[model samples]
Target: MLILGTGDVRQVLDGAETEVVAAVRRAYLLHDQGRTALPHSVFLRFPDDPRNRIIGLPGYLGEDEPVAGIKWIASFPGNTAAGLERASAAVILNSMATGRPEALLEGSVISSRRTAASAALAAAVLASSVPETGVSLIGCGVIGFEILAYLRAVLPDLATVTVFDLDRSRAEAFAARCEARWPGLKTEVAASAEDALAAHRLVTLATTAATPHLSTDACRPGTLVLHVSLRDLTPESILAAVNVVDDADHVCRESTSLHLAEQHSGNRDFIAASIGSVLGAEEPYRRAEDRVTVFSPFGLGTLDLALADLVRRRAEPLGLGTRVPDFLPGPASGADG
Candidate 1:
């Protein structure tokens, strides 16, 4: 088995934003063609602390280099209070030929990158006409930072970013980091979420809100919302937008904003199409000029498998990870003594 720590994974993916986006796009295409198996993510939540959860996402990708894996990730929002990351994860990839685990990887990086890549890809496909010069981010955490990075890679014209967070200090710090990372880019810390939402035509919601607290009233027409956090927008807001999700069945569960919209409207017809369908469409997807568009991805497990496979394949040639020859017991040599 191969063991890849966080540093190894990051080293493999650091300047590979475009490649990561392409991998995520392929995963979506495979899913659209029904070439992947993705089970619903299992959420384990503590009764004592409703804000925290551990999710198990298992999937199989049937691309040319077929692979299977499960990403076990935990989201403890309170971890930020201790100056730690709120989410941590690990991914185990299984060999398709032998059905044995082959690689263990640090997953939080993979998770965040895949997520950011998905959002960037969706923006390219769903909001092609939207301006690329400016964007608004409603969260200022690790995920938000990654989203900005991936977006900049895909949308090279991106120049200005407006960010808002519940914590003012965090937002300021995120702004500083952004400027330091990309010296030429401009970053602003919005005074409120509404200000951030209205600041640009491209908006990304990556907050940790457990319930709906925001609506689309603050947004400009033709705004493209990358709804990464899933729960930040209200049901009415979702229903009003041109909803495009990665997977309808997968996203419409879990009491996400889209799920709440389904509950409120008692139907899924509000959803215009899946991102996969848009990507695979013979004709380009067209939208009204004055309507809002929201891309709500459930964070597909297949994406993680695809990316983890990419990392493993890349790392193998460079000898970047630790190899454990005895990770799994070899077949019994004759009968046990």
Candidate 2:
């Protein structure tokens, strides 16, 4: 088994935002066409630590280089207090020919890249055709930085950015990073969540809040919300707009905002369509120009698998990772029978 570290993975990516977006797009299209196999994500909770969980996502993305893999990722919200990253992950890829695990790549980097790509892709598709002055970011953490990086790559017209965080210092620091990327950008710190929500035409919510806080009234008509943090908005807020998701079955679970919306309404009538359907469509899905558009992705394993494959292929020729040839014990046992 070949093990690729975070440095190796980042080297493979090399700040290529368009490539990452394209890879994420392929994953979505394949899934939409029923060409991928995605089992529901499995979450393991600690009895004593309710806020901590390790999730396992196994999937297969069919293509010329069809690959199967599982991403084991852990989320510890408390880690922030200790000044550590909130999440970490590892993706293990298995070969189809030999049914043997081929590579174990450091997954947090790939995970964040794919997530940012997904959010950016949604932003590009759902963003208003009208000219936007700036964008707002609710949380100013690593994920926030990732989203900003991708947005800078995709949205060249961005001239201003507003950021909000519970910690004023963190928000200010995040603003500095944003300015570094877009030296011409006007970066500001929002006084409140509402202020941040109303900061611009395009908004991204990446906060670590555990439950619903954003209300329907917070959004402006024609606003494009990249609901990256699944649980940020209230059920009524979700119903108040035309909602899009990466996958209906996936998003309407784990008591996410969409899940809450479904529960309150007892149906998924508020869901407009999957992001896959909206991408490249001639006609707009949001029937009303005044309707607020929201895209909530459940972070599919299909995406992780696709990106992992990309990293693995790129890392191979460079001889960047550590290889353990005999990770498994033996060969097939059926011959004895």
Pick by lDDT: which candidate is best?
1
- In model 2, pairs of residues that clash are 1-324
TM accuracy, model 2: 0.95
Local accuracy by lDDT, each model:
0.93, 0.87
Question: How accurate locally is residue 268 in candidate 1, as Cα lDDT from 0 to 100?
Answer: 97
Which pairs of residues clash in candidate 1, taking residues 3 or more apart in a chain or in different chains? none
lDDT of 2 by residue, 1-337 (tens): 8999989999999677898899999999888888899999999988877778899999999898898989999989888889999999999999999878889989988888899999988877676767666889998988888987888778878778899999999999889887887788899999998988887878899987768988757667788888998999988889988888999999999879999889999999999888887774778644345978888999999899989998888889998899887777676767565
Distance from true location, Cα of 12 in model 2, Å: 0.9
Clashes of each: 0, 1
Query: Which candidate wins on TM-score?
Result: 1
